[model samples]
Structures are given as C-alpha cells and as structure tokens.
Target: MKEANITDRQKKENAIEKIGEFHRFGSILGLERMNELMKRLGNPEKELKCIHVAGTNGKGSVCRFIYSALLANGYSVGIYTSPYLTVFNERIELDGEYISDSDLAAYTDEVLEKVSQMTEEGFASPTEFEVITAIAFLYFARKGCDYAVMEVGLGGRGDSTNIIEKPLACVITSISYDHTDRLGNTLAEIAREKAGIIKPGAPVIMNVDTDEAKREIA
Candidate 1:
C-alpha cells in the first residue's frame, strides 16, 4: 500500500526503527487494528478516564486546559498530543511531567516487542502517531495516572485515540478550515465528522468555533 512520508529522524538504527515500521503499515483510517492493539495491551484505557480532544487547531490548548483543570482538582493527569511543539517525547506526560528520556527509551523497547509481533502476525505496524499513541497509553497505565487527556492526531471519526471505548468526556476544540482534504468542507460537514466523538449521549464540551460549528455540535 502507498505510505505517508517518513521523518528523517527515523533513519536512526535504534528504537525509532519500530516507529518507522509502524508508519509503513499505518494507512486507511479505521479502528480495527487499533482496537486489536489496545486489547493486546490488555485495555489499559479501560482503567483510565480520559478527555479526548479533537479539532483543526487549538486541540492542544484544549487538552492543556483539561489536563490542568484535572490536576488542580487533585487528579493525576497524563497528556498526549500530536506533532509535539518541539521534542517527540514532549507528546507524552505523566502527572504534569514529561516522560523521562530513560523512560521513553525503555517504553520504546516495550512498544517494539508488541508492535513487531503485530506486524509478524500480518497486522499493520501502525502509524507514527499510532505507535506514539500506544507508548503514551502504556506510560499512563504503568505510571498510575488517574486520568489521561488525549488530543486526536487526525479527524476524530477514525482517530487512533478513538480506540478508547470510554472517556470522561469528549471535547471538540474548534472546527475550522484545516485538513479539508480529509474532513470535507462546510462547518456542518466537518461538524458531522467531529461529532463522531459523541458516545451515545456522552457529555461533550465544544467551547470554540463558529456559530455554524456550534449548530453542527447541536
């Protein structure tokens, strides 16, 4: 299958190789493989309450808000975001702290063992986003986080984070002009897509975006 571009950083002959392999087979937006992978990991997401945030922009900000609020409320919060502001490991946090270099290294090994087996068994390796997502899940689970805030890596409808069957709530940051090639145009259309997060009457918060966007939310 055709693949997305691989980052130059993956050229390294180390743990990131698994990350690269993941990108190779990670195409076609769906929850089957992700659900399977999460199950193999024993559904760490089940024991955790999560705030899943998604939108074109301001997603990270929304997650930051939820994470901080959860922390201030005396809850241990773990956060995971996409396209880190700078460093890759910055994407994963444990109780308001970034995952340590040593922990990232160790976790990469654990991630690789599972990811490799998945690939060998004819499962897609997962995308860069998916692999990191898995690592984030494992970290949060192992670290005993009370809640984890996850920002969708792409459209909410088929995002890897959707593998989490339950969440404290779903938050759509702002629906605007971005990723149109995948999400479609018109606020209503995009809203329909973002609305995928609504889990059968689950509580949702959409405090950003246009009136049309809000209409879509309604």
Candidate 2:
C-alpha cells in the first residue's frame, strides 16, 4: 500500500472530516426503509456471520474489545459502531483497518444514489446514521469479512443492526434506564428490550448480573 503522501493520522483526520458531512441518524428507525436501502446495495450484511451486540451503554467499548480480540485471534473482523469518533469509516473497520478513501467515496456515492431514489419513491430520506450504516455493511461485505461485530446505535429492539437474522452470537451489556423516554422508564421494561438481542438458543454474555436488581433478564 503506497502512502497517499499523507500520514496515517492525516488520512484518519481526512476521513473524519468527510464522514461528518454524513449525518443521517435522524431518519426513520424502521426495517422497511433500511431493508429497501440494503436491497439497493445487494444486502451485503447477509454475507457474513453477525455478532449482534446491544445495550444502553458500554456498547462501544464492548465492540472495541471484541474487535481487538478478533484481530488478535486472526479473524477478519468488521466492526460497526455509532457516531464515529472521527471519520465515518472509523465506525466501520475491517481487520483493524478502515476502508480506503476511494472506497469510502464510492460507497458514499452509492448511498446517496439510493437515498435520492428512495426519496423519489416517496420514502423519507435516510438519516445520517442510516446512510453510514448502509455504507458499513457494504464495505464489510466488499472486504469479505468473516465476522461483524455490530453495536446498536439506539435501542436494540428497533435498531438497524437488528435486521440480521440468526446471528452466530447475541451479546448484551449492562442495561440501564438512560433512554427511558424512548426505551421505557422502568428497569424491567428497559431490560426486556435490551435483552431482546438474546435470540433463542443463541449464546448471551453479560457483565451485568444479580439476584435482586429488580431486573433479571441479564
């Protein structure tokens, strides 16, 4: 890989700058629209084994931990996180590497094309998050990743990552009442939704525990 005359740090900074312009988190949080968007890209997420992770917090750190471990273990890992710390591509990494600028540009162009068509088809334009999420899936699939660690950008029950079916693993972190207004105010209700990621027979890992926390879902 010839250096693009820019240091790795500079490239990361540039990527972040480019990603900041993509702000689609405000779009509708429904499967119907995301499904259509993914279809436009040929549903790249379906090609890999998904490790669906959900929680009220600690989701990003957990994603990072899983990504690091996978990298150490020699698996090609695709990580999908929210609200990139910098570049949008940072939210979607493959084997600890980000998709190249050219790749991201191409992916972003595809997303914009889909969004324009969707709007013409009477669907509300995708939110910044949706566009980027779609891009992540496409980038991962293009790289031929083996496993994808997905972190819910919002509540698990309706998150875009929930689009996956029968993921190899479903992991949930400590559930809390932070998103009460959107996920429920009570501990049990919130716990139930967070635990929604625990598909039947799928392995569930949790650092959250207890016999008397008012919520035993974890």
Candidate 3:
C-alpha cells in the first residue's frame, strides 16, 4: 500500500512529538553531535552576540534579568532558558515575547528535516534540548536580535548551549552541588563545569559563594 500523505500541521506535530521523545533518550553531553546539527542548520549561533549564563541555580533568573536590562536599554534581546514554568514556548523568546506557536512549529519542521538528512548521512539525531537551542539561535538571527541571553541547560562544558564559541560575556551565578550526578559532587568540581561557559578573552561576572568554588572559578 502507498504511504499516506501528511499535512504541514501534521508534519509540525510529528516534529514536536519527535522532540518530546528526547526526554526519554535523556541528556547527552558532548559538542560533536551539537556541532553536526548546527552545521546542518548553517550555524546560527555564530551570528549572535550572546551573554552565556551557567550555574546550578539562578541561571534562569539571571537570564531574565539580563534580558530585561537589555530591553530597557533599547537593545533587541533574545532569551533562551529551560525547564519552563509553564509551556515549552517559554524557553525561546525575543523582545519579551515568547516565540509564536506557528513559528515554533515551522522551525521545528525545518530542524527535523535537517535531522533526517543527518540520520541519512550517518549522524545521530540531536537531543531535544539541542534542537530547541538551535531553533532559538536561528530565531534570534532571523529576527536581528541585538543580544541573546542564553542560560545553560546543563553543566557548561559539554552543554549544547556551549556551541556558541564567542560570547560577549560569561556570567556564572551561585555554583552549588545541585547536579552532583552530572556535574560532580564538590564545589570545585561543580565550579569547573559552571566555568566551562567562559570563553577565552570573555569577561566573567562570577558570584560564587563557596571559597573553593570562587577560587576554582577565578
């Protein structure tokens, strides 16, 4: 029997469903897969002037504060945060407006197509967060954002958001032993992962409380 045709809405739903499955797949660190995915999407992250935020807690709040300050200063800002309090659309936004549903679906479709191509070419599909990060970057680039405040979804070094090789600044909020399972148990070790968001030559605003963590971050 011939395969049934799907509508664009259906395509969008399928794409979103595929991304939803990433949670089951779990978080996978390492930049290789993220790099491959970005390459397929034309590397939108490179076009952005971003402020990277990393920490066990308060990263989301930090991102929001920076975003607000930038908007108040008349800069067009893009926001990328995770574990939204409400819907997934809250994670990617611009100029204080969440990404529209149609826009989200459209971008998801495009990204999914690229993912399929990657799979065909022997590359693994990007994790859900990775895909969402790419979409945010693409959306920001397309909308001409003056700055993007990006909150690291996981530990900094291998986090998907770390793909931005050159950020305007790196801000490390209060580092703690919250993600001991993924980022290590000690303050120093957690500080190291949080510090991974630091790009060489990029100024860092660190607010580490623990002396060991502060020293390690410094």
Candidate 4:
C-alpha cells in the first residue's frame, strides 16, 4: 500500500509540473492553437453536450447550480471551472467528485503528446488554460458525460473553452467592469466579448444588469 501511494503521489506531482510549464505562455486568448490541438486529439470536446458559461462574475456559482441540477436529475454531468481554490483536480469533476489523480495524469500525458506534435509541426504551444481545457474535454468525453458545464477562463470570444463548436446552451452571467485591459474598458465592449460564445442556434440565458451590456448581447 505504501509503495502504491508513493507512485500515485509521484504521478500527480509530475503531471502538475508538466502542466505548470505552459504558464510561461500566459493567457493567450485565441482558438487557433486550441483548435489544432483538439483536432490532433480527435476533437473530444465535440463529443459531449456542453453548457458554456461566461461573464466577469458569478460563473462558478452558475456552473455549480447547473451541474448540481443535472446530477439531481440522474444525469452524468461534467463540471469544468477555473482558478481552483485548492487542488488542480478541483477544476475538473464528474457528478460532484473531483477527477482522480491517475486520470489527470493519464489525460495530461495524452495531451502533452499532442501538444508536442503541434510544436514539432510549427504550431504554437497551447497556454496553460488551453491545455487544462483540453484535458477536461477528453476526460468528460471518455467518461461519457451526459452534460458538461464549462466556465470560461477569460473573455468568451476567444477563450480556449470557446473551441466548443456548438453548446446546448450559452449562458452569460453578471457582467461587470473586470478584465478591462483584455476584455475592454466599457460594458458594451465586455458584453460583445462575452456574447461571442452565443452560437447561431444555441439558446442564450443572460443575467446582465446594464442596458448597454444587454443591448450588445441581445
């Protein structure tokens, strides 16, 4: 038992270190690298039904509500959120349980192979958030989740999570003056970025208080 526990700890530590390497790339908000990476991985994000949530605030709460509701209704739900308060595994969950360390390491290894291929092929390396998003998609798809609630890491328009072609629903929560440098200085600008997640046919649910933001999204 002691030997097995040590092995598991080593795997988790190695996986976390490898993933942390991409942090040097910072938050590059674009889908080009993510699209290529997903294609190389067989496009796992397309296999699962997704609910894409975006906004400056309340994204985590909204995602939790949706995930819990889905689970209560006997659905196998995958929850993907950002900026985990504690462990890295907290960012990915299925049916309220965090992803296992073994699964995280296995999926991280798979994604690392594809990322290396991308680099060898002259494609840019994916950012840290992008890599994590890819791992979550693979986990949710392989686990055969009925629904996946995805929280946007940054602005919705070009966020790695935006690689999802079509989601079951697009949700824009309370938008505020946040990420002004990256998103925009005004509410309308931020709203436009968040609105990018709204696909042509996907139903949208929003909770913006500002008319300027609402008009842009509407």
Candidate 5:
C-alpha cells in the first residue's frame, strides 16, 4: 500500500509538471488547434449532450445550477468549469464528484501523448485550457453523462471550449465589460464574442440586461 501511494503521488506530480509546460506558451485564443486536438481524439465532445454557457460573469453559477438540477432529477451530470477555486480537479466533475487523482493523472498522460504526437505532425501544441477541456469531454463521454454543463473559459468565440459543435442549450448570462482587450472595448463587441457560443438550431437563453448587448447577441 505504501508503494502504491508513492506511485500515485509520482503520477500526480508528473501530470502537474506536464500541465505547467502548457503555461509557458500562454493562452493563444483560437479554435483551430482545439479542433485539431479533438479530431485526433475522435471528437469525444460530440458524443455527449452538453449545455454551453458563456458570459463575462455568472457562467460558473449557471453551470452549477444546471448541474444541480440535473443531478437532483436522477440524471448523471458532468461539469466543466475554469479557474478552479482550489485544485485543478475541481474543473472537471461527474455527478458532483471531482475526478480522482489517479484518473486525472492517467488522463493527463494520455492527453500529453496525443499532444506530443500532434506536434510531431506539425500541429501547434494546445494550451492548458484546451488540454483540460479535451480531458473533460473524454471523461464525460466515457462516463456516459446524461448532461454536461460546460462553462466558457474565456471569450466564447475563440475559447478552447467553443470546439463543441452543438449544445443542448446556449446560455449567455449577464454579459458585461470584461476581457475588453481580447473580446472588445464596447458592450456590443463583447456581446458579439459571447454570442459566438450560440450554435445553429440550438435554443439560446440570455440574461443580459444591456440593450446593446442583447441586440448584438440576438
């Protein structure tokens, strides 16, 4: 048991080290690399039903509420959110249970292998968020989650999470002035970026109070 525990610790440490490698490149906003990574992984994101939530604020709250409602109804739900409050495992959960350390380490190893292969083929390496998003999709799909509530990590358009082709619902909550440098300088511009999460034929739920933002999202 002592040996097993030590091995587990090593795996976790290795996984964290690999994750740190991604931060060196910083956040390059674009879906092309994300799309390529997903495609290489057989597009696990398409295998599950998902709710895509985007906005400058309250996205995590909206995802939590939706996940809670689904779980309360006896459905298996997965949640993928960013900026974890404590640990990286908090960013991915199944039925309110954070992924186990063993699983996280195993998935990180698997993802890193694929990413390395992609690099060999001349594809740009995915960012940290993109890798985590891919792992969440794979986990949710493998776990057979009935619903997955995915929170946008950044602006909707170029964010890594936007690789999801279509979602059960597209939710934009309380869009405001934020990410102005990357999203835009004005409410309309920000709204346009947030609206990018709205997929075709998917119902959109909006809670933005700004008329200009609402119009742009509409």
Candidate 6:
C-alpha cells in the first residue's frame, strides 16, 4: 500500500511537470489551436452543458456560487477556474471535491498524447491554460457531469475557454480595467472582449455598472 501511494504521487508530479512545460509557449489568446486540439480529442467540450462566466473581476466567485447551487440541488457539477489558489487540482472540481491525483495524472497524460500528435503534425503547441482547459472538458465529459460552470481564464473572446460553442447561459460580472495589454485599455473595449462568450440564442446575465460596458455588451 505504501509503495502504491508513492508511485501514484510520483506519477501525478510527473504529469504536472509535463504540463508545466507548455508554459514556454506563453499565453497566446486565440481559438485556432484549441479548436484543432479539440477536434483531435473528439470534441469533448461539445458534450458538456456549460454556464460560461467572463469578466475582469468576480467571475471566479460567480462560478463558485453557481457550482455550489447546482451541487446543492443534487446536480453533478464541475467548476473550472484558473490560477488555482493552492494546488493544480483545485482548478478542476466536481461535487465539492478536487480531481483526484490519479485521475488528474491519467487525464493529463491523455491530453498530452493529443498535444504531442498536434506538434508532430506541424501545429503550434497549446499554451498551458489551453492544455488545462482541454483537461477540464475531458474530465467533465467523462465524469458525466450534469453541468459545468466554466470561468474564463482571460478576456472571453479569444481566451481558450471561449471555444465552447454555446453555453446554457452567459454571465459577465463587473468588467473593469485590467489586463489592459491583452484585453485592451478602455472599458468598452474590455466589455466587447468579455462579451465574446455570448452566443446567439443563449441568455445573458450581467452586472455592468458603467455606461460604456452596458453599451458595448448590449
């Protein structure tokens, strides 16, 4: 039993290290690579019923609220958030539990195989967040989640999480002036980018306090 635990821990650590290697690719904000990668992975994101949340602030909190609400109502919910507060597993949660180390390692290896194929086929490598987003989609789909609360990792339009075709609902919370370099400087420019997650026919819920944000999102 002790040896098995050690082996599992080692495997998880190795998987995390392999994922970290993609950080060298930096944060390229586009969906072409994500779209191609998902195509190769059998398009798991399409299988999920997602509630997409995007904003300059409060999106993570909103995700948690929705996740908790769904879980409390007896739903199998998965919440995918970025920049985990502590461990990598925290970024992918289901039913109030972080993804197990064994499962994380297994899914990471599975996605890494697809990523390797992409590079071998002469496609650009996925960024770290893109790889993580792929893992979340795969995990949620395979786990038979009833719904997924997906928090945008960055600006919604080009962010890796925007790859989802349509969500059950699109929520934008409190857009602010942040990530000015990547998401643009003005509130309206930022709101437009954040509004990228809004798909036609999907209901939108927002809490924009500024006229600029309201005008752009409306």
lDDT of each: 0.77, 0.75, 0.86, 0.94, 0.89, 0.94
Q: Write the per-residue lDDT of candidate 3 for residues 1-218, one digit (tens) a residue.
A: 12322354455566668689766657888888889988989998999999999988789898999999999999999999988887677889999798876678888878778888988999877888888888888889889899999999998999999999999999998888787888888989989888988989999998888899988888
Model 6 quality (TM-score): 0.98
Model 6: per-residue Cα lDDT over 85-196, one tens digit each? 8888999999999998899999999999999999999999999999999999999999999999999998999999998898999999988999999989899999999999
- Kindly report which residue pairs in candidate 3 clash with one another: none
- CA shift at 102, candidate 3, in angstroms? 1.0
Which stretches in model 4 have alpha-carbon errors above 4 Å?
Answer: none
Q: Which candidate is the best by lDDT?
A: 4
Error of 1 at 98 (Å): 0.8
Candidate 3: lDDT of 37?
86
lDDT tens string, model 4, 1-218?
A: 88987887789889999999999999998899999999999999989999999988899999999999999999999999988998989999998899988899999999999999999989999999999999999999999999999999998999999988889999999889989999999999999999999998999999999999999998
Q: Write the per-residue lDDT of candidate 2 for residues 5-119, one digit (tens) a residue.
A: 3555465555446545555445445677778888888888889788888877789999899989988998999998877676556777888687766677677777778877988
Q: What C-alpha lDDT does candidate 3 achieve relative to the native structure?
A: 0.86
Each prediction's RMSD over C-alphas, in Å, is 6.7, 3.5, 4.5, 0.8, 1.1, 0.8
Pairs in clash, predicted candidate 4: none
Residue 190 local lDDT, model 6: 96
Sort by lDDT, best first: what order?
4, 6, 5, 3, 1, 2
Per residue, candidate 1 scores C-alpha lDDT tens digits across 65-169 of 888988899988899987778666688987768887567767787876777788799986577777778888988998888889989888888888887777778
Q: TM-scores for all candidates? A: 0.85, 0.83, 0.92, 0.98, 0.96, 0.98
Model 4: residue 198 alpha-carbon error in angstroms:
0.3
Better lDDT candidate (2, 4): 4
Q: Model 5 Cα displacement at 164 (Å)?
A: 1.1
**Residue pairs in clash, model 5:** none
Worst 10 residues of 1 by lDDT: 1-10
Candidate 5 regions exceeding 4 Å error are 1-3
